[model samples]
Target: MPTLTAYPLFRERSLLYLADMGNSKLKTSDSATAPLQLAREVLMIEAREVQALAERLDENFVNAVELILQCRGRVVVTGIGKSGHIGHKIAATLASTGTPAFFMHPAEASHGDLGMITQGDVVIALSNSGEADELLAILPPLKRIGAPIISISGNRASTLSRAATVFLDAHVSQEACPLGLAPTASTTAALALGDALAVTLLEQRGFSKEDFALAHPGGSLGRRLLVHVEDVMRQGDAIPVIEASRSLKDGLLEMSRKGLGMTAVLDEHGRAAGIFTDGDLRRAFESGIDIHATLMRDVMHRQPQTITPEQLAVDAVALMEQYSISSLLVVDQQDNLVGALNMHDLLMAKVV
Candidate 1:
């Protein structure tokens, strides 16, 4: 029998045959490095394409922003295939950042979805080749509807670009796909361009955090931005509070009953005078103080950390973390104790 390595053609064929088998242990240096090398190249290609796009940006990009800004209606983004996927994300980002926008499938536009477009609306169409048949077929109707088209395409000379009110060149030198057929780098460029437009519109509209929170009301971001201290603070009798003249025993009972891990000591005027917590109780115990005889005013911490009910719950978390305390007292404009909240309250509210 001849050794496999004795014949180069037989050895190459054997390796190729082994590669076809699903779990073959045969390995080659080139095969091992190819994936990593190709991945890096893809990233580099996409990055270069985006950088080129930035350089090629002219007055047209500015005009596109102005057009969207002036429109009284929503921004209708339409595309096909991968471009449609990117358009969906672009529309979402725009809507969340202050621009009222939605993705409209180009094929569906011909099936009566065209009515979604109006004279006041601005249309953003994405097509790398600028010749997506479905996209081009609806150009005339979009024109007749009086909606200005902003075309993002790789080929500026394509029909879509020629018919557009403003053309944005999203051309890339080459695709990240080794075969040059997949829409890798081009899709990345289009996505980046869409992001640039959405963010620019957001800045031009002076979109604030509150506006963003409104759009994302179901997420943690909404909780952090929209939830105020009053929303999570335990109010009315739920507040663990005792008069300063009350005994430590009374304060402990209030803390236990409210389950806030602490109790607010109120002054004669019913203001938040101090705070007493488990730590204070332990120290008081170590000091050999009489829990029944000692007043809250004598054992409580005076002028403890306080927060306004109108403030955000996230801010309350910050104050707690800063002071290394587990609870906070909510006060009103006149320093009247209104409510109380501990870490558990915030955690239960999912504000933390």
Candidate 2:
């Protein structure tokens, strides 16, 4: 529970090095010398501390995950200082990964936000020293409401850990800070532990990508997974269409009018024969073909790729990326053109 620096040697050496550097520019500090070496040592120290925490994981982590899964209400996370900042991220991670959670500032809880905590809920209290006064103040109220307290703290015997329903040890031997006072290593360990807990609960709950999309409908991930081609495609008469016997000029007029850079060519049976694109027009011009008299089918790409409306928009993007095409023809179960969409549509819909 000591807040005192544990690595005097490191602190002493770092202080002496900084003193030698005086006011020299840190951006131009010699990579082989004191400044760079000091930064590396801090990183290595924090990294080692995190590895040590991971190596010490045991039944406590499993118990913590189980505690959360059994709760019928939201998980209320509470912490102070640096641990509080880490707690906010942990709560977000848990919520996004399918475990309902929210950060409840300990001070807010003391100031009557305690109403936010109710029965059947779980409390995740974070404090490295396990002596955060604001956090300790709410444990009795939480216990009285039949809520479980899960403590992530470095001190196993501290007041917070002793009062918890479950204790998760996140002890770090040293901080990345040379003074070992700012919570560098301990905060990282707590965050990593929180991630482990959230992921384990997510797997246990059988959380799916579909479920995630529902939780995050406003983001690109939702657009990719939830939006279908039918949602963004130009349907019915908006699709540019022409018969195979039509003049290339007729297809060009349809393309210009539709503004989709391409026109769908239908066969005599009214099924898709092929598609004539701007690319095909350029090739015809290069070959000196008669655009004014040639039939659409002769200059079009036969067996053009098409998609069904039920397919995901992201799948459509993948198809376009794979085929190197900006536009795609949408077909029905009967292999008839129903709609068309291009890269611009995807971009406008934010499905790109």
Q: Specify the highest-lDDT model's number.
A: 1
Which residue pairs show collisions in model 1?
Answer: none
Expressed as tens digits, the lDDT of each residue in 172-267 for candidate 2 is: 877787655788888999999999898899899999998999899999899889999999999988999999999998989999999999999999
Clashes of each: 0, 0
Total backbone clashes of candidate 1, pairs 3 or more residues apart or in separate chains: 0
Which 10 successive residues of model 2 have the least lDDT summed?
A: 1-10
**TM-score, each model?**
0.92, 0.90
Judged by whole-model lDDT over C-alpha atoms, candidate 1 comes out at: 0.91
Q: Which stretches of candidate 1 lie over 4 Å from their true place?
A: 1-27, 30-32
TM accuracy, model 1: 0.92
Estimate candidate 2's alpha-carbon lDDT, on a 0 to 1 scale: 0.89
- Candidate 2 lands at a TM-score of 0.90
lDDT of 1 by residue, 236-260 (tens): 9898899999998888999899887
**Which residue pairs come into collision in candidate 2?**
none
